[model samples]
Target: MQVPYLLDVLVSVLLLLGLFFLLTGTFGLLRLRDVYARMHATSKSTTFGVAGVVLASLLYLRYLGLSSGLKESLIVLFLFLTAPVGAHMIARAAYRAGVSLWQGGVVDDFKKWLDENR
Candidate 1:
């Protein structure tokens, strides 16, 4: 009984962390200014949040003594593989759309490089 319950508890903790990252991502999207910042919020935090949730799902299935955890594990695999591509596309679009950074922001290496190349 205790062993089963402990696994449930672990799953719950992971789920909570997942939710925290999700909420954080949403909050960052709303609170931050500019397209670049919004992409930053949406891309990184949500990816990690989903990762946490997927890990929790795997544990939850394992705790249930299911015959396989492969399905749940696959969800995490899909997330890891796709999240970065989505972020890159978003960032690229924002750049082309001329979204500028906040005033006095340092490090315009990207712009500098583009200028030099063109």
Candidate 2:
């Protein structure tokens, strides 16, 4: 039926999109000049990437009459909740430990904040 065909198309698109973002995150992790930039890239892109893949899985499972994808939904919820917070903690620790930004970085907002708050 057309419904199944549409679902297939949507799942395929989500998978491809997820894979693209995952690849981009990996590339940024390898190629970026500094930790902060690497974290930013990986956290943002990979979160969305994994979300897309999980959503696709959820849809396919629903199509197959599986149990409503509660596990996949939880995974997405936890990933979104944790990834950015984890990245922030790591970045803050790195900054406190004197990890310098890339030479080409344009902003030092955290540094300014620390200075202002001190």
Candidate 3:
């Protein structure tokens, strides 16, 4: 068994990374020029945040050898799968609602991609 000190440091580092994701998500939501950008920020940040926290919990539980129901595992997997879809839907809805990209947005891959999809 690894020492508690090492586990404590690991948990602390994980928490810091989680906090970084959360703050960046908030900043992106505020500073980004368009809804699509906002969605991209939130999707990427929150998925990682949720994954990190879930992984930490999973590790802690397993380290103690608890008979957990694997709920943490499920959460990590669920977020990983769904976050991108949710972001895509948000971007699509924004596009349909006529939210334009920022000035100098330069490339509209999503626009072209959507055009191709339809």
TM-score of decoy 2: 0.87
* Tens-place lDDT digits, model 3, residues 75-98: 888888888888888887878898
Collision pairs in model 3: none
- Which parts of model 1 have CA positions greater than 4 angstroms off? 1-3, 65-67
lDDT of 3 at 99: 87
* Per-model root-mean-square deviation over C-alphas: 2.3, 2.5, 3.4
Candidate 2 segments exceeding 4 Å error: 1-3, 112-118
lDDT of 3: 0.80
- The sequence of per-residue lDDT tens digits that candidate 2 reaches over residues 38-103 is 997899999999999999999998888776899999999999899979999999899899999989
lDDT of each: 0.84, 0.92, 0.80
Question: Which pairs of residues collide in candidate 1?
Answer: none
Please provide TM-scores, in order, for all candidate models, with all chains considered together: 0.83, 0.87, 0.81
Q: Residue 93 of candidate 3: its Cα lDDT?
A: 81
Q: Which candidate ranks first by lDDT, i.e. highest?
A: 2
